[model samples]
Target: MRARYGCVCFAVPKKLIQHLADRSGDEGHKQMLQAQITQSAAMRGTRASKTVAGVATNAGAKPLQRSVFDAAGQTFLPGKLLRDEDDPAGRDKDANEAYDNLGIALQFFSSVMGRNSVDNKGMRVDASVHYGFHFANAMWTGEQMVVGDGDGRAVKNLSGSLGILAHEFCHGVSQHLVPGGLGVVQVAGMPPALKGEAGALNESFSDVFASMIKQWHAGQDVKAADWLLGEDIFTPREGRAVRSLKEPGNTKLTWREDDQIRDYRQYKATDDAHRGSGIPNYAFYTAAAELEGKSWETLGQVWLKGFDQLRARSTFLDAAHATLNVAATLHGKGSGTHNAVKAGWKKVNVLA
Candidate 1:
């Protein structure tokens, strides 16, 4: 079958990696990081016109089927199968983390959202861990998920980061949720890419849902939640998390090189998807924090359902409106959740 879309959703932003590479004093380490960026681009191009296997939502399959594989320090995807959903946890720490985290995400989405796996129709979730040599990224490549063992010093074991895993998984969800792929743009001679405001929505939705999953799994409310993405993936020396919904551009809460912007006023058409997502990330945070309860409840559902109606070329304002409509529909027009949703967009200056 043709690719559902060619856009690859990566956990680590290219800009951040570039920043790290640029600042690295060791030429060898810098070259290693730069090579990753090159390989990632090549991977995207490889998948530009074709889909990878292992993402079919067959009928009568397990309600939530999953499998884990070991990339064994290679770029090959979904490499040697290490464990299946029915198998016991393997000794490989990265493989086990991938399997367990995927299960957690499946449970949350299934039990709470009533969605069956990534495709919402029992599509199997396949993951590959330990991808590449010191590769500091994770991604959903249209068909399956791939994770890398980050350089031990700066970016560490991405598979161990539940937020990172969940964030990438949500990319699959978005690919399946939004018809034609969320914010996917196809130029005459370019691979289908996620760009502009729609691209930001894609990244923001990943971050928002990842945050919701993190909070829900920890049994924490919005107030109690750390609201950090990829907290476990980074060392204290490099940074805390990848991004913070609590504060988009606040490097102290996230990392030193985070270029995310919370206000729409700061957005540019050329901003990377991760950086541009900050506006909506803060919008979701604003609404959820005000709701003062578990994020996956009404607010989270409203946000998810709102994105459900979006197309490939949606904008931040488009997303804000969709979520607002969902909130008003699920909760009464003037309900607290509805007001919160409205206020979230207005606060981000998207609605205003």
Candidate 2:
């Protein structure tokens, strides 16, 4: 009961493959160029320089001083895994959860997608928890995915949920494929309205992949899904699960502005305050669920190829168009896979 990429290696878009051939002069060379392109494309829509309110940077700042690991082969949680106490105080429990979840996700990815690791290179996946002083967020800081205690309110432990860990780690995957080689393309340098949406799309890709990993572990059923974003991290009193996969803006977390927090609507990933990514997140879930079967198998590959073929500073429409090209390449111009992608974006009000 195993599937392989060889069983379904979507044809690289002819035009794209030809373009790679023309640019690199050989298939191997073209692949290298394409990998570089994919890495660069991931950072296209990120206006990451403005210093968004929740975002943090600093390679040496190990607030929790946690240990990390790389899950290469078959590894499972609740087994031979590290504990949060292996690091600084208060970080042990969460760190343990994060470490265990990373193994779960890695196994799900390899078993399903046939990818060796996030970079398909068996790169060690490092995670640090208890970042900053009560910092209420988690992020992939180019080098590692760090999590905070979430202000001890809405999110008590960022590492408490597998989905959250998977979400942050997926950012690493995005980094490896998209922004990995592009360096850093600031948001201010983007081409207008499409700015945040592109970044949001990147975030949504993480959510999609993370959800797929979770679903795959649960044996492919969303109905039995926890559906709570960072649920384990959030206190029961906080109410609401992690971000919704089918419906956005349907959380119980009520902040100052009900519209902002409770609504949980996904927004275009622009320089528009760095919140509201739920809309695009929901759209991604819709698309993946619509595809059915193993997520990494079909939907994930389509997205990987689509993102790989795009350029830095791409817009939502650009993403949609690139996906169309990839879907058509992977599943023929008139195939159901192509149509599914088109409908997925169209349903979300994003066009091809």
Best by TM-score: 1
Q: Can you write out model 1's per-residue Cα lDDT over 155-215, one digit (the tens) per residue?
A: 8888888899999899989888888887787766666678889889989989999888889
Q: What is candidate 2's local distance difference test score? A: 0.51
Residue pairs in collision within model 1: 183-312
Superpose all Cα atoms of candidate 1 onto the true structure and report the RMSD in Å to 1 decimal: 2.2
Query: Residue by residue across 275-330, what tens digits does model 2's lDDT show?
Result: 33454555455566676655566777787677776554566667778888988987
> Cα deviation in Å at residue 341, candidate 1?
0.4
What is the lDDT of every predicted structure here? 0.84, 0.51
Q: Which stretches of candidate 1 lie over 4 Å from their true place?
A: 48-60
**How do the predictions measure up, each by TM-score?**
0.95, 0.63
